[model samples]
Target: MDAEQSIADEPEVTEKRGLFGRNKLATSEPKPAKTLGPLKMIWAELAKYPGKVALAFIALVITAAATLAIPAGFKLIIDNGFAAGGNPDDIGRWFRYLLMIVGVLAVGTALRFYFVSWLGERVVADIRLKVQDNLLRLAPGFYEENSPSEISSRMTADTSLIEQVVGTTVSVALRNILMGIGGTIFLFWLAPGLTVGLVIAIPLIILPIMYFSRRVRNISRSSQDRVADVGSMVSETLGAMKVVQAFNQESREKTRFEGAVEAIFDTAKKRILLRALMTSIIILFIFGSITLIMWRGALGVSTGEISGGTIFAFVVTGGLVAGAFGALTEVYGDLLRGAGAASRLNELLKAKPSIAPPERPQTLPLPPRGSLSFRNVTFRYPTRLETAALKDFNLEVEPGETVAIVGPSGGGKSTIFQLVERFYDPQAGTIRIDGVPLASADPAEIRKRIALVPQDGVLFSSNARDNLRYGNWDASDEDIWEAARAANAESFLRDLPDGLDTYLGESGTRLSGGQQQRIAIARALLRDSPILLLDEATSALDAESEQLVQQALDNLMQNRTTLVIAHRLATVRSADRIVVLEKGQIVEQGTHRELAAANGLYSRLAALQFTSSDAA
Candidate 1:
């Protein structure tokens, strides 16, 4: 089965490589080691919108400056405007000036938010598009080793975290840094001795907080992981509800979900407790230092060593500095999280497709003859390197010829289709379409001449029209109807509520297994490719549906080159030639009557199948 189908069938907790190559629970967020270097990718994206970035930066500076000016404005109102002999006009002027600064602060802060948020959303949108584009270029082998579920989570959860970093965290960090620096300078100007004392106390306050914050962060990560665990369990249980009910295991499932929820609650409780302790410690240190500073300032006021306005400004600015630094402590952790997200996203963005067009690709011959040849091909799937799927296999099919490949389960019947599509290059072979080597031509060009009907019909979540037209996007409604009629899908297609416009639902769940297979056949008919591949195309259909579809396929195969993989020996009786594969090698090849008479492997398989059919 494909990776996506496997993940859907069994939604178990798996492990994926973390940011630094260590395996971790897939549900947990990736953690970055010591550096935020991956943020450079975000910067690269941000650089695309220079005007918006510049505007945000300018507004950020204005807001920070306005914030610092507030304390100075208050000091002027107190020392000059509120003095004993001050005129009412002087008081009014200072108050108006302070109000003006507030106006600028409000406008600048709004502008900063708007511009920063725009840049964040734009950058994320671009990254997602680029990542998806690269993902499309990747070969199927990549999906074999990586879970689509984990990759999907990175695409969504990781990108959303990046959006937060761009929109909120980075802006807050920059603004707070400016405020912290500006506030500290102002504090020193107001009272040098007091500023030195505050600076010394700053480390003592921050060091303990930092240590506590580290513990809190770790607990918070664990808490989030537990919540993710709960979410995964809920999804798994709901997805398999039918199986659970059939097995009378609803009570077991309930207990399992309850256990998951309690685990989440327990982790949350620890995080909350740590955060509460941290908050209490922060309050004691911050307020205690403020009290000491206030007492010293009070003595200075009594001795007339400094004015009331100066001490007041000093105290206010000191609070602003402390708050700024505290906000900064949280910023680093957020940046680290963003860095982890960026690293994972970068991995996707930077991935080079293993199967790609060469620098100079050879164009396939015009007016395709659909002739395909496998010359001494030896191939192995990347995941199974030790076992060759095809060992020195050779085959040649001319235009307008039908070749049926009959095989047991692991006999390399499907590998031929994969090689013909150029999804992977064989380890030792030259596969050619119309005399053009696959490796020398673009994969798109190679696949354009081929059509495939898989054992299971795969459909997208869309209207029937779209699903049918997927094989040939430009096919007209009339063309689609003709193909549907040929595939015996016209009656069912017209019976739907909205006809062609009815939503097919995910994977065409609205259609029956036989109906879905017919739709798949109709799609291939619409493709009008010269080379057709049918991998148990009628496997899901009933006897009648199979017979009708087989007649349609026979008509379609008359002029096209066809390769059929059929386990039902009866289906290949009319083929020009039948090749029976065993363990990656063709053990016998002949007409049905000839092979059956020879009493070889093909004869044995045919005897067993025919006997089973007779018994039924």
Candidate 2:
């Protein structure tokens, strides 16, 4: 196999082996968590706003207390207000007391909703910030094994689930627990015999609901996965719409998306069906028990063992208790879903970059020297451990020198740039910038001294000024124009409607290929780093554009150490030295004419290109 293809075909790491794996978002669902323990992560975030939490809890308690108080208030009204020959003033007083309880319940519920929802929104925002901060710290290899789109889904969908848990589910669960306990006590107070019967029936009400709930929970997870599949499909198809249309595969894409949508519908049906069954069981057991208790209470009332007021209070409070428990069963399932979301987010939060500066890091020397060296380097990508991209490679470039590397595809051309920037650590070798080993120096410091113009000009969705000054954020407008002039970008940039302030479309798509490449060259020029890496920088340009960019590069490289990777042999004829590589080893190194005369790999490659040019 070609070396480059071998490198590209490496298997992604699957150590965690579930949702984090590449393409796993649509293909797999994580195992359902056995408990709600993962929700503690959400609690930790909630704990940051202690005052809000306290207010919410206070409001929740008040609401529950007021809810139970209504029954007591009703008991007074029924027993006294309508008592035979009761005083008119006494009747009005009892009615007013009941109305007051209703008012308190209303106000307390609004407060509870406000505070809990505030906590929920605040926690999710904080978590998103923290997760994003960690994601930026990770190395490129991490992304190779993990799909960014899947990670984004976790950021959005999972966080939304957590928001619901914090804002609604937890609050509901707590309030109901208070009501269930408080209401049950009131029930026993009104009629002990009846409360006993109600209590005994509680397990029967909960058991069947729990059974159906387990089924619902499993299907709920699958339902979420199916929805994620639909989302991924839409994103994938839309992102490659041009390709789909170009190949006339629109129908195939439509069919694929329809399949995903149908899958979601199927999964949702199972979850909803189970939920419906659970709801039915809750009603049957709870109301049926309430009816039986009322029948028994009626007998006591007839015997004068209980007042009509007492029986009314008992039944009302008993209903509240039963309703609370029923709500709890549903709340438990929601909490578990939140726990699953928390677990996934927690993984991202806890992820440590494989490459990080050591404690007591060695600092690169002041007054940057454009010197770089690779010593006995033998390395394979994490995904492709069997094939080495670079093997026993050694080279050194002095300050202010230019070295051109030309080779067959996948001759470790791009791999050299990868290591120089410390994107990956070689399994066996030491790479140094200014004589400081990369592992001992901060990766940021190593990268600060090198500027790269990759095969493609990568730009962000921002204004031209921001894209131009990306490498040097502090660059003045004057400095920017100077760099642009050197990069042959100033002419067209000045012609833009908004000049430097014009918004560049995503990835600079509005710009032509040559224009984007020139912008990239200008960016590197603005960086003014000691060392430069040009990976086929002019390969994408037309003849005129290439000449202009090559001129700009010449000015840019005057005082810098430059490493150029090119397949076009004519471009490197003037380099200080040329190195030829094949099958991950350096086969020859010399001046271009010397290598051309030697009839080695470089000579043959140069012959192929120059001969083709002459024929054309």
Global lDDT of each candidate? 0.85, 0.85
lDDT of 2 by residue, 197-257 (tens): 8888988877886677656656665666677677778888899999999999999998888
**Global Cα RMSD, each model:** 5.7, 7.7
Output the worst ten-in-a-row residue range by lDDT, candidate 2. Answer: 1-10
Model 1 per-residue lDDT tens digits across residues 1-616:
1212212222234566543234576643445536989999999999999999999999999999999999999899888998846799999999999999999999999999999999989999999999999999998777776667767888998888899899999999999999999898888888999999999878778887878766765666566567768888889989998999999999998898899889878877886787778778878998899999999998998998887888888888898898799778778877997898898889988878989999999999999999999999999998789999999898889897888998788999998888888888999989999999999999998888999988888899999999999999999999999999988889999999999999999999999887888888889999999999989887767888787777667756768899998866556876888988887888999788788889888877876767745313
Error of 1 at 15 (Å): 2.9
* Separate clash counts for every candidate: 0, 0
